[model samples]
Target: MIHPTVVSMVAAIRRRANEYMLRQLSDLGLEGLGPSHAGILGRLFQNGDMAMAEIAAAIRRDKSTVTTLVRKLEALGYVSRRKAPGDARKTLISLTPKGRALRPAYERISRELTELALEGFSSEERKALMGLLGRVRANLSLR
Candidate 1:
């Protein structure tokens, strides 16, 4: 029997990585959030404020998923959503004071995840792996 295909291996890695992030989130008292929330939070942290469609594009998720995630974050007081001043049809999401304060913890968790995933790899190996994975991702992109 085959050990496993590349797609299966990558998927397994993602599942395990998500579990690791969830456990880290739990330890940090971020109970209601999970791995899915990280992309939204991290993007907001980097880009300041962004519209729903912008967040969806940045995170590679659909607008509906971004809407749900932003709504949950707003309900939790981690983010605030409001209509854009110039465009009534566009809504922007920004981090609240509570969300802004999560930077340190978020960085720590992200760093730990990287360390855990590449614990045995040399710097060159890590770089090569990233390049290969990036190529694979690009290959699968539809647009």
Candidate 2:
């Protein structure tokens, strides 16, 4: 059985990481983009333009939630919706110029996060930690 101390520590660490990342994102003019928005933006950055359903599946969020996020992003001029050429009923979501400009700041914040998370770890230890995390993720996926 998992120890109570370990569970509490894990919860605390998760909360701290979330708060720190959100603050960093806000400092970069990414205000209003909470954890949900961050997940959408991250997916857009890596995968380029995608349909609303595609994004929802990629992020494992319900379509309604993603739609709300897309609406907010559209209002902020961070994303644009275009009618698919082949299918008029389908809309594709892509980032706008303003959104593209935020990529560098996003990357910097991610680097800062990595550095902070690994501050006390030796190079070997960091590598091992990363490997273990990847394995854990894979194991969970099998379930």
Candidate 3:
């Protein structure tokens, strides 16, 4: 039997993970939001209010994509955008009460994902796997 390529394996894993998260989100009554929106919301949920550019960077998305995601989040009553306190050119994105309320579900989803991904792995093995994946990511990030 032919072994699967690393890229294919990783892509498949990501697709499955995103699908699982989307299903969980739908079950929680958040029907319209996708992984991109989750990325932005997750960042704001963890870091509080952040500038648009910062959100884009943190989510590893382009500014235009982040703009669209932020708009969707705003429409869903999960986030709000305002001009930065000192910089009119910069906009800050923050979570609303509705968004904050999703924290418990998000935390549950995160824990579930972690447990699913690391199933049957010992602590040391999981750490090593993460370290190896980090190196792989770093390798691909080189210019």
Best by TM-score: 1
Candidate 2 per-residue lDDT, tens place, 1-143, comes to 96576447757877887899898877766778765677788888998999998999998899999999999999989999998889988789999998877788777777888799899999999999889878866777899
Clash pairs of candidate 3?
none
Q: lDDT (0-100) at residue 66 of candidate 1?
A: 89
TM-score of 3: 0.95
Query: Candidate 3, residues 1-143: lDDT per residue as tens digits?
Result: 99998889999999999999999888988888887677887898889999999998998999999998889889989899999888899999989999899888888998999899899999999999999999989988994
Per-residue lDDT tens digits of candidate 1, residues 115-136? 9999999999999999999998
- List per-prediction Cα lDDT, in the order shown: 0.94, 0.84, 0.90
Q: Once model 3 is optimally superposed onto the true structure by TM-score, how far is the C-alpha of residue 64 displaced, in angstroms? A: 0.9
Top lDDT prediction, candidate number: 1
Q: Could you tell which candidate, 2 or 3, scores higher by TM-score?
A: 3
Cα lDDT, model 3, residue 138? 93
Each model's total of backbone clashes: 0, 0, 0
Q: Work out the TM-score per prediction.
A: 0.96, 0.80, 0.95
Off by over 4 Å in 2: 5-10
